[model samples]
Target: MTRLNHQEKAKEFDKWISWKQEGNKDAETELIMRFLPLVTKVANRLAIGLPATVDKEDLISFGRFGLLDALQKFDHTRGLQFETYAMWRIRGAMIDGLRENDWIPRTVRDKAKKIEEAYTRLEQEKLRTPTDAEVCEYLGMTEKELQQVLYDTSLAAMVSIDEAVGEEDEQKTARHSYIVDEMTPRPESVAEAKSLKEVLSKCIDKLPEKERLVVSLFYFEELTLSEIADVMNLSPSRISQLHSKAIFRLRSALTRWKSQLL
Candidate 1:
């Protein structure tokens, strides 16, 4: 199948809008068929890292409603492209659907909002992308507290590109339409990382009950050594020693497993 350029798609969209305005049934079908892939694309982008129970098809269905709304409200003579307007509508619809379905928890959403605000403030103050330390300082959070916030925020956040702001021409075009580069670190590297994580999990499981608890609190729960020590009723130095020993065991196991795989 031949791919339509943005201009061609915009022209077709205008025709669909006219047909729908005239109450033509066939035009509605044509419009849906032409833009279904676009709906799916936006849905996929919004649903990244979401659970399997949230069906992609459901998001597309919701996006169709948004497309219909956009078609009805579109003013072609105003010099704005339909695709550009419809993209936001479609994305908003999908996100609204997820929100209605309770896919995001209130706590997670709050954290994401806080992180976004903190980032915005830091960017304004620094006039550049600030380091993680800068963010921690601005938020008045210790490193461990900051990491927990980041992890929670990531759990609920949707991946989106930077939208073109304040530029009519750029706003009318797809901001990130080009294919992303796929030549990242090798598969072997990813495999190695996965192997290391698995080995570390196993090593942690083998620790004495107190040590296991300490590791879980420090890594998975993002707690500080002092916090873990208080929870386990041990000295902070003892918790530190246990953490170092656990890491050493994990590294040794991973090294052995890697040699076998080779």
Candidate 2:
């Protein structure tokens, strides 16, 4: 998609409104073209850490199919917003394609699993979050090796977040849409959003110091890993490892909470 000025964006939005409300067949091509930006955005994000052999266009193609599927199957009358749902579907589709392609090696996934196991076992044994030194010792790995493993598994953590988590025979809620309230009678209620956010806030508070800071800087402050490394005076590789560990803990917490709801 070409870079659009404010007026151009407004015009496109107007076209979308017409296509949505009036069912204008003439605007359908424009509609598909407009979706390219969304696909491109997700493709770029997921392209990180991928091997050079993996073409960016392939990821975009996967996301394009997701967008097409989303457009076809989406219930316009359900009143649920489309963009958020479609984002998850697009990411999920790209990850699905990557998995089928074996883009992430099995060894990396096994290493990540072992690290998580070490976290759980050490926590159960000591009744607290395990220190990095302790986790390294438990895994019989050097600090550098642990960092490499964490970095390798970071993409897996990302794939986990891309899951579509609903139980319907068809479309389900997007897992990465963050928190959707199952407890509330009204899923769209503002209080429902707040409650789920509070749960995540509490989980963040429970993280160890360095991991917590890494998440804060990366998510809240929107800093890249290299920028975070500069601010923290650590290597970018180390920051990537911390980011991976932080996401792993978050994913575990959210999954457990979701299971309880189920």
Candidate 3:
């Protein structure tokens, strides 16, 4: 099938929605066939750069279920276009699949859960996102320790909410309601982000042992200078000095690389 522009897709979606409400099975099948590629594309993008075990095709399958959900729950009266509403469901289905598949190790998942909980508590208490220092303090770890944890466990990053909640169709299963907006970045931007991550990893590896440890503990583990000092058995001032020097070196390296790229 030919791809449609957003406006044309929206019209097609509305017709499907109307036909679906009247118990039209054929319309439902047609809608699924028409939009399955879009759902698969979103799923594939979400799985990009993940471990091979993540299985992009599995995410696509999960997204198919989410697509059905979108078809059923869409409401034209809300003045929201269907594609805008469906993207979230599609992504959410993929995440739910990941969770069910046990792709993330149990220990890492536990750590991620703790981090999430800590963030939640901090938000409730402070009414804002918790600072990196606050997270270190809460965990009773030094800054370096926190950074190590963050770097080592960075793969545990939470799924974006854009891929989490969405409206569900009445005739379909009760899927989470997610708000979809037009914030999806271009594919090239996604590729650049991946390249930057690889570069950062390489840079981290090239640091002197002490500087590398400091960088890992401070940035990835989310440790404050004092906390890192405690772990390294040094004064907070010393840890701060090390951190400053490491950051300067990293910035200089990245600057040179960017200049070369340009």
Clashes of 1: 0
Regarding lDDT, does 1 or 2 come out ahead?
2
For residues 1-262, what per-residue lDDT tens digits would candidate 3 score against the true structure? Answer: 3657889777776666667567777777777777777686666445422454667788888998888888777775656556655766787677788778877787865765565566556655885445668977997888787665544333345342222211333322111121111222335344544554555567567656776787777555646555677888976545544553344344434444556667
Badly placed stretches (over 4 Å) of model 2 are: 1-25, 48-54, 78-80, 169-171, 179-198, 217-236, 255-262
Better model by TM-score: candidate 1 vs candidate 2: 2
State the displacement of the C-alpha of residue 36, model 2, in Å, after optimal TM-score superposition. 1.4
Identify the superior model by lDDT, candidate 1 or candidate 3.
Answer: 3
Q: Given candidate 1, what's the lDDT at residue 68?
A: 79
The prediction achieving the highest lDDT against the true structure is 2
Candidate 3 lDDT (Cα, whole model)? 0.58
Q: Supply the global lDDT for candidate 1.
A: 0.57
Query: Over the stretch 1-262, how does candidate 1's per-residue lDDT look in tens digits?
Result: 1477889777776676668567777776777677667787666554433445678898898898878777667665665555657866786677667677887678866765666666556555765544667767877888677655544443243422212212253233221221121111335344544554565566557655665775577545646555676888876545544443343333344445656776
Q: Could you give candidate 2's per-residue lDDT for residues 151-213 as a string of tens digits?
A: 888777667655654446364544445433333224554454455567677777889888888
As a whole number from 0 to 100, the lDDT of residue 259 in candidate 3 is 64
TM-score of each: 0.47, 0.76, 0.46
